[model samples]
Target: MKDTATPRFRFIDHTSDLGVVLYGKNLEELFQNAALTMLTIMLGDIPELTGEPATINISVSGTDLSDLMVCWLGEILFLSEAEGIAPCTIEIKSVSPTLLEAELRTVSVDPSSIIREIKAVTYHEIKVEKRDDHWEAKVVFDV
Candidate 1:
């Protein structure tokens, strides 16, 4: 199958915090792209890494796709904090309106290489919906 285009994420800087706003054609793509953006902030030019791939298994549930997206990214942050891992690739195994399961893979990074650490994923200004058969969502990361 031809690879689908990935989602687009924009960084936003507030007086007190930094975050990203993301848009995608589907829920899976939205979540995957958000993760990529977050990791990019943590490690710049991720395409330059030649390290071995690492994998992460994630499962999350929420009242809606919007909430689910936040929860999904929250798990990734948890992995970074607890396991010292940074994910570069995400693969969705299954997703529903309220639940999602996926695998994430990335190489390790030096603690000093992280310029900014994301504290959490938030529900603020979050949106997830379908437009002309394409799914889309917006999320903000707490940095």
Candidate 2:
């Protein structure tokens, strides 16, 4: 697919919270874009890390794709806060309606690299759907 034709993400602001939502033509793409969106929120702009790459492995299960999306992103957020790392790229190993696994590659964050801290992932206004050939999801992050 053309780069411009690939998945995309957008930010959504609520009364007291901010979040990201994403859409793609496939489940893997959707998850990948969501990871990018989450990283953007944490780093504003994803920094180029040329060395000492760290890999994060995540597996999440839910009853549906929407819940799975939340869990998948939540795992990334959890690792970022707990491990003090910022992911710049993601590779989806597998994805199903109820299960997802991925390898997240990132670099350790410098003390000054943190722009915003995300506290949790929320279920508010979360949605996932298959429209035409595309899959879409909206997720909220608690900052």
Candidate 3:
């Protein structure tokens, strides 16, 4: 078990790739935290969007919890790398064992603020589990 008393997500230092541990009281919050973590990593600064941020819907499906996390974060990465968007906020509207749907509020990225480019979201040491009353996930990115 890891610390769960403070922020919902925290970055983990990795020798090569980027990593984060996400905590949530439910699946919705878990996914939301995951998205935020990825955005924070990509943007370097937490974005505060105002005046007509772009809104988009995202959906992904996977076979299990760990797979779901990868797919979910992968979509977020796609929005950044391919679509030139950095998410300001994520609202996980619905989630189930194998599927997720969310609304993202985003803004165009500032290329210089991107600390490092995330090549992909990897399966390395991915874990999603319930501990006490909340769920936690550990994810590593191929940067």
Candidate 4:
């Protein structure tokens, strides 16, 4: 979402849920883009950095890369719905298969503007892989 331009993330056909295939060049970019994509799905579009931005330092650990991906996006969902903070910019300083550290530029948003309610970042069909030139992740959200 930050590095891969044309299609940051694309929708996948799902009968009963919402899905996206996220793209990036590395694990850090992949996680950063994943957070951006999750925010877009929640807010319909990425909201501009409007006012004074707040920096949020986030660190999450997982059992593996897949679980790390899930935890990464799940934290975004938690921030949006529970904290009333919309992510504007994501800067992941460190990322590994088991640990991720990031800084998010966020702003306060009107909760009513949130059109879609993503209940959770589901594990169904979730994937994170390194391709020949890029990294990709398949994520489905429970709506």
**Would you estimate the TM-scores of all the predictions?**
0.80, 0.86, 0.89, 0.94
For candidate 2, list the clashing residue pairs, or say none: none
Comparing 1 and 2 on TM-score, the stronger one = 2
Q: What is the lDDT of residue 8 in candidate 2?
A: 85
Q: What are the per-model numbers of colliding residue pairs?
A: 1, 0, 0, 0
Tens digits of lDDT, candidate 3, 1-143: 24456687778999988888998889998988888877777776657887789999888999998999999999988878787787888889899989999998988875666787889999999999988978999999898
Sort the predicted structures by lDDT, highest score first.
4, 3, 2, 1
TM-score order of candidates, top first? 4, 3, 2, 1
Instruction: Identify the candidate with maximal TM-score.
Output: 4
| Clash pairs detected, candidate 1 | 25-135
Tens digits of per-residue lDDT for model 1, 17-62:
6756666566677777777777777667453435678666878898
- lDDT, residue 10, model 2: 72
By TM-score, the better pick of 1 and 4 is 4
Instruction: Indicate whether candidate 3 or candidate 4 has the larger TM-score.
Output: 4
Worst 10 residues of 2 by lDDT: 1-10
Q: Residue 20 error for model 3, in Å?
A: 1.9
lDDT of 2 by residue, 1-143 (tens): 33556538877777778866688778898888887777777888775767878777878898888888778878877767787776777889999989998887788777467688888888888898877777778888787
Index of the highest-lDDT prediction: 4
lDDT of 3: 0.85
- Colliding residue pairs in candidate 4: none
Compared with the true structure, model 3 gives a TM-score of 0.89
Candidate RMSDs in order:
3.3, 2.3, 2.3, 1.8
